[model samples]
Target chain A: MNTNSDYPKRICSTTGFPICRSAEFFVKANAVLGVVFLLIGGIAAILIALTRWQAVHLLPVDWFYRILTLHGINMLIFWILFFEVAILYFVSTTLLKVRLASRLTAWISLVMMFVGAVMVDVTILLGKADVMLSSYLPLLAHPAFYLGIILVAVGTLIAVGNYFATLYIAKKEKTYEGSVPLVVFGATAAAIIAVVTLLHGAVVMVPTFLYSLHLCPQPDPQWYRLLWWGLGHMSQQVNVCAMVAVWYLLAAITTGAKPLNEAVCRSAFVLYILFINLASAHHLLVDPGVSAGWKIWNTSYAMYLAVLASMMHGFTVPASVEVAMRGKGYVRGLFGWLTNAPWRNPGFSAFFLSLLIFGFIGGITGVTLGTQQINIIAHNTLRIPGHFHATVVGGTTLAFMGLTYYVVPLLWRREYILKPLCRLQPYLFGIGILIMSFGMSFAGSMGVSRRSWDIDAGGSIYGPTAHLFLALVGIGGTVAFIALFLYVGLTVGTLLFGRRIAAGKSMEDWGTPKVLSTSPGHDHVAPAPGFAGGATVAEAHPTQGTMVLAVIFLLSFAVYYFANWKALADVWPVR
Target chain B: MNQESSSGLECPKPGWFQAPSGNERTWIGMAVIWCLILSVMMPYWHFRGKQNSTGEAYRVKPADFVKRVEAFVKVNTGEESLVEDGIAPVVPAPPGEVYLLAKQFFWFPVLKLRSGETYRLHISSADVQHGFSLLPMNMNFQIVPGYDHVLTIKPQAPGTYHIVCNEFCGIGHQQMVGKIIVE
Candidate 1:
C-alpha cells in the first residue's frame, strides 16, 4: 500500500480499495448536496404531478410553471450532475489508488456548483425565470438563471478536468498496472462526454445569458434549440455511461462478477464516446430549420452505433452476473441462477432492478421514440418525459441509489439504520417509476401535452382514457414520492445515527462482498483455465437466460417502434 | 486485517482482453442489424409513407409572420358561423395555403378546413417559441418565433381538433388552445 500519510490517503478496511481522504471528503460533500437537491426536486415533482393529474390540480398557474422549471433543473441537472461528480472522484482516485489530483480545484468546483444551484433556485422562486428546462429562445428568463446554469456547467467542467488530471497522475506514478479497470474506463468515457456537453452549454448559455440582459440580439430560436439539446440530451447520455459503470461496479462488489470480455465492454464505451452526441439531433427531429435527411442521419447516430453499445452492455452485464451465480452452484434451469442470486442485498437488488428497468423499458422506448419519423407522433408530449423518466429516474438514479447502499457501508464505515426498508426501497422505487412512465407514455399517446399546467384548460374534454392515464401519473408519482422520501430519510438517518463499522471487520448486516481474485471460495467464478476464450468457457457457464431476455427486449423494441409508426399512419397525412 | 488481492479494484489479470463469443457475439450482431433497421425505417417513411416532417421552414420576423397570419385571416373570414364565444375569428381556409399563429395565451383565427384536400399549413409564433400540437389526431410541430414551419397536410376525418401550445411559453401556457374545424 502507498501509505502516504502526508497527503491523507488510506486503504479502505472493508472493500480493500484505497481511499484518498480528500477525495472521500469531496465525494461525501457532493453526494450530500446531491441528496439535498433531490429532496427539493422531489417536492417539485409531487406538486407538478398533482397539478397534471387534473382531478387534484394542486399548484396555481404561475407556481406550476415556476416549480416545473425548478423541478427540471434540480432533478435533471443539479442532483444527477452532483452525484456524477462524486462518482468521478470516487472512481478515479479510489479505483486507481491515488490521491485526488487537486483538492483545491475540487473545493472550488463544489462551492461554485452549490452557489450556482442556490442562485438558480432563488431566481426561479422569485418569478424571474418561467421558461421550462429547454428555455427556448424568445421566451427569456432572467439573466441570473442563465448565469447560474453557466456556473454549474463551468464547475462541472472543472471537476471533469480534475478527474482527467487524476488519471494523468495515476498513470505517471504507476498507481496500478496495465489498462485501467473497467469502471475507471467507463468513468473516463463519462468525463469525456461531460466535456463535450459542458462546451455546448457554454456555447449556448453564455449568449443566452447576455441576451437575457438585453446585451445581445436574440440567438435564432431554431439555433438555440439545436445547441441547447447538445447540452440537455447529451447530459443524459453522460448519465447512461456513468450508470452503466456503476452497474458493473455494483455487479462486481455484490456478486463477484467480472466482465466476460473486456474488449467488448471497452469498445461499447468507445462507441458511446464516438457516436452518442449525435443523438442530440433527436430532440429537433420534428422541429423546423432541420431537413428530413439531417434529422434521420443524426437521430440514428449514423446507424445507432451508440445504441449498439447499450445493447452490448445490456447483455454482458447480466451474463457476467449469471456466470458468477451459476458458479455458486445455482445451475438448474435457464433462470435458476437469477432466481437464486442475491435478492436481499440492497446493492445487488438495486443494480439488477436498474438493469431491467433501463434495458426493458428505458432503452426500448428511447430508441423507438427517438426515431426521426416516430418523433413526429411523440415530440413534446408526455411520452418524451415517460421515456426519460425510465432512463434517468428508474435506470440511472436507482442504480446510483444502489451503489450508495454499498458506498455508505464501505466508505463511511457505517451500517444501515433500517435493514428491511433498505431492501424494500429498490422495488418500491422501480415499480413506482415504471408505473409513472407508463402513465406518461399512454396519456401522451392520447394527445396530452407535457409542461401544461392543466390539460383541460380549454374545456376540451379528452374522454376517459386520458383521464385514467393522468390518474395513473398522479398515483405513480405519489408512490414514487413516498419511496423517494423513504430513501432520503433512510440515507440521512444511516449517515447520522447508524453504527460505525470497527476497523478490521466486515459489514455485519450485509454479507462481506465476495472479491473475485482474492478468495479461494470464489475460485469457481473465475474464467476457464488459461483464458482460452471460446466454446469451453461458454459451455462451462451458460448465459441462455440472458439471451432469452435479450430476445424479449428486441421483440419489445420492434413492437413499440412499429406501433408508433402505425399510430403515425392513423393520423392525417402530413409531410 | 484481510490481505485482499486487488481483483475488481485493480486491472484484470493480464490477457483479459478477449473477444466476445457465443451468445454475446450473436446478440451484438443482432443489435447492429436492429439498429440498421431502425435507421432504414426513417428514410423509407420519408420517401414512401405519408406521415413525415419535411421541416420546410423559412425565416421571418415575428411581426412579419403575425402580419401574414392576419392577412390570411382577413382573406378567409366570410360567412362562417361563430364556433363558441367568437373571441377568435372562425376563418374558412381554402384548399391552398393556411397560416396559423401562436402567441402567449392563444392561437389566432380558428381555422375551418375541408377534409380530403391538401393545405400547406404554415405555423409560426408571434412572440416566443410555442408548439403547434393538434390534439385528438395528435399531429404536432414546432412554432418558432422567426421561422415559418410549414406542414402540408390533409385531414382525413371531419371533426374539431384542438390545437394546444405544448411548448412552455409562460404562466398562461395551459390556456393556449385553438380549434381546427375539419368539415
Candidate 2:
C-alpha cells in the first residue's frame, strides 16, 4: 500500500482514463450546454412574461404555444438531461475510481441527442406543431417532432447502457468492493427509472405518430393519458433522484462533509423509488373516469411518502451543512452559521437557497394541489408552471449550477474567471424567482388563467389585477434572465481563458490548500481487507461476466420494443 | 486539563414576536412594517369576502354544503333522466346559501334547488391551476394563472353550471368538469 506522502499527485497509471481528464471533458460539455439552453429558454420565458404584462399579444397563438413548449422542454428537460449525463461521468470515474466503459459509445450518444434536440427545435419553430410541452393527445404535431423525441430517448438508452457496462467492468476489476459508491448507486437508480420511462414514451409516441399520418383512426385518449404520464411522471422522479445525489456530492466537495447518517440518506432515496411513480396521479386529480378511490390512494396518501423524502433531505442536508460550518468555527447560534458562513462560496450558497425556495413554494403547492377537490380548480393555470419552476428551476437547476462551479474547476484543473460574479449570480436569481413566483400565485388566485393570449376578457372584473401581476412577473423574469446570462458568461469565460494549473499540482492542492500534515484527520487509514487485496488480480484479467449482463439488459429492451411495435401494428394495420 | 463547557450557558431569548439580531432582524422589521401597512389598507382592498350580486355571501359553510350535497344526490339521482342527461338535477339551496368546491382545475357544484331561480357563482382553487369557468356562458377566471391561487365566476343568471374544462388536462382531463342546471 502506498504511504500518504507517496500518493500520486498526477493522473492514475492504470489507463488514459484519469479522473481529471474525464471530469474536465464532462464538465466542459455540461457547462456549454447548460449556458446555451438557459439562454434560449430564459429569453423565451421573458418574452412571454413581458408580452403578458404589456397586454400585447406579441406571440401569435402558434408562436405563444411553441415558445411555452420549448421554454419548458429546453430548460427543464434538456438542461437537466445534459447535466445528469455529465454528473454520471464524474461519479463513475472520479468517485468510483474507474474509466467509462467506452468513450466512443458516449460520444455517439451525445451526437444523437444533440441531433434529436435540434430537430425538435426546428419543428417547433416552423409552426408545424404547437402542442405545448405536455403534447396531450388529439392535439397533433408534425411527424418530425415525434421522431426527434424517439431519437433522444434512444440516445439516452444507449448512455444508460454504457453506464452499466462501465460499472460491471469496474466491479469485475474490483476497483471498489461490495456495495457501489453512494453517488453511483443513486445515479443507477435514476438510470433504471429513465429506462422504464423512455420505454413508456415509445408506447405513447409511436402510436401518436402513426395516428397523425392517418395510419390509425385515432389513439385512445385514456390509453394515451396513462402512457404519457408514465413517461412524464417517471422522468421527473429521475430528476428528483439525480438532484438529491448532487446535494450529497456538493456537500462532499464544498466542506468535505458526508451525511451524518448514511442510512437516512439511503432510505430517502429508497422512499423516492417506491413513491414517485404513484404520485403522478396527483396531476389527474380533477380528471373524470378514474375511480375516486384510486385518485385518493395515488394522489393524496401515496405522494406524502415522496414529500417525506424531500422534507427529510431538506432537514438532513442543512444539518450536515450546520455541522460542517461549526467545524469551521462559525459557531455563533443555532442558525448563526447561515449568516457567518461564506456566502461567496457559490456551491454552498446556491444549494442552500435552492433548497429553501423549493421547500417553501414547490412543496406547499405540490401538497395543496394533490388534493382531489383542490385539483379541480388548479389543474392547468399559470400556477402549474409557477409550482414546477420552484421545484425544477429553483431546486434542480440551481443545484446543477452550484455543482458546476466546483466540478468544472476541479475537472479542468483551472481557476474560475470571475469568482466574485459566480458568488453574486445565485442571489440575483433567487430573489428574482421569489418575486416572479409570488406574483404568479397572486395572479392565479385572482383567476388569471394560463396560456391565454389576452388578460382582458371583455368585462371580467379581475382584468386589472391580472394585468398588474403579469407585469410584475415580467419584471421578475427579466431580472432572472440577466442573472442567468451573467452566470453563463462567467462559466464559459473561465473554461476558455482561466489560468491553467501546474501539471504536478492536484486540484485539491491548488485551491485554498489545506495543511495535510497538521490537520487532525490527516493520517492515512489503510484500506479494509477485501478491496485492496482483490484490486491487483482483478485489474490483470479480462472477464466475460460483464458482457453477459449487458446482453441481458439489451435483450430486455429489444423484446419490449418489439412487443410495443406488435401491439401498435395490431391496432393500426400498415395497409 | 478540564475544559470549560460551552453548552451550560443559557442562550438569551429574544422577546416573543421580536426580530432576531443582524441582517435577519432587518428582514423581520421590514416584514412587520409591510404587514401593518396591509392591515391599514385592508378596508380599501374592496374584494375581500364581499357578497355576490344575488345578496348571498361568497363563503359557504362546509357542514351545510355536505348536508346539501347529500340531500341533492338522494333526490335528483332518484330520477332516471337526471342520470341520463349527465347533469346534476337541481335541488334546493337554503334561503341565501352558496355551495363552493375548492378544486385544482375547475369548479364542480351540485346546485340544491329544484326551483328555476338564478344564483351567483364565485369559485376558486386553493393552490395552483384553477378555472372558475362556465363555458356555455363564455366566462373564465385564471386563478394564480401565473403562480398563485386563482378564483373564477359565473352568475346564476345562466341557470346552470356550464362545466367547461378550461385548462389542458393530459387527455381525459377535459371530461372531468360537469354541470348543474336549475330545473
Among all candidates shown, the one with the greatest lDDT: 1
User: Model 2: how far is A412 from its true place, Å?
Assistant: 2.9
Off by over 4 Å in 1: A1-6, A509-527, A532-539, B1-8, B80-84, B87-94
Q: Candidate 1, residues A1-575: lDDT per residue as tens digits?
A: 33333567777776677788899999999999999999999999999988888899989899999999999999999999999999999999888888898989999999999999999999999999988888888888888899999999999999999999999988888777888988999999999999999999999999999988889998888888899999999999999999999999988887777677778888999999999899779888888888988998889889899999999999999998887677666666889778777888889888999999998889888998888877888888999899999999999999999998988887788899989999899999999999999999999998898998888888864888898999999999999999999999999999999999898887764542332333444324444455433233455678999999899989988988887889888998998
Q: Kindly provide the TM-score obtained by chain B of candidate 1 when compared with the true chain B.
A: 0.90
Instruction: Identify the runs in model 2 with alpha carbons over 4 angstroms from their true place.
Output: A1-27, A54-58, A301-303, A457-461, A506-575, B1-165, B168-183
True contacts kept of each: 0.72, 0.01
Assess every candidate by TM-score.
0.96, 0.69
User: What's the C-alpha lDDT at position B91 in model 2?
Assistant: 46
lDDT of each: 0.86, 0.57
lDDT of 2 by residue, A1-575 (tens): 21112222236322122463544465467557756777788878887777666454466544666787788777766777777777776677655566667777887888887788788878888977677776766567898888788887787788788788877867777665456655676777788778888888888989888888888776755457667888887787788788778877766556544443444555667777777777667666544345545665676435356666665565556555554444454444445545655566788778777877776677666655554444444556566667777878778788888877776566666778867788899888887777787777667655455665554422343557667788777878878777888878887788789887566554432121121232454222222333222112112221123223223423443353234223222210000
Candidate 1 to truth, TM: 0.96
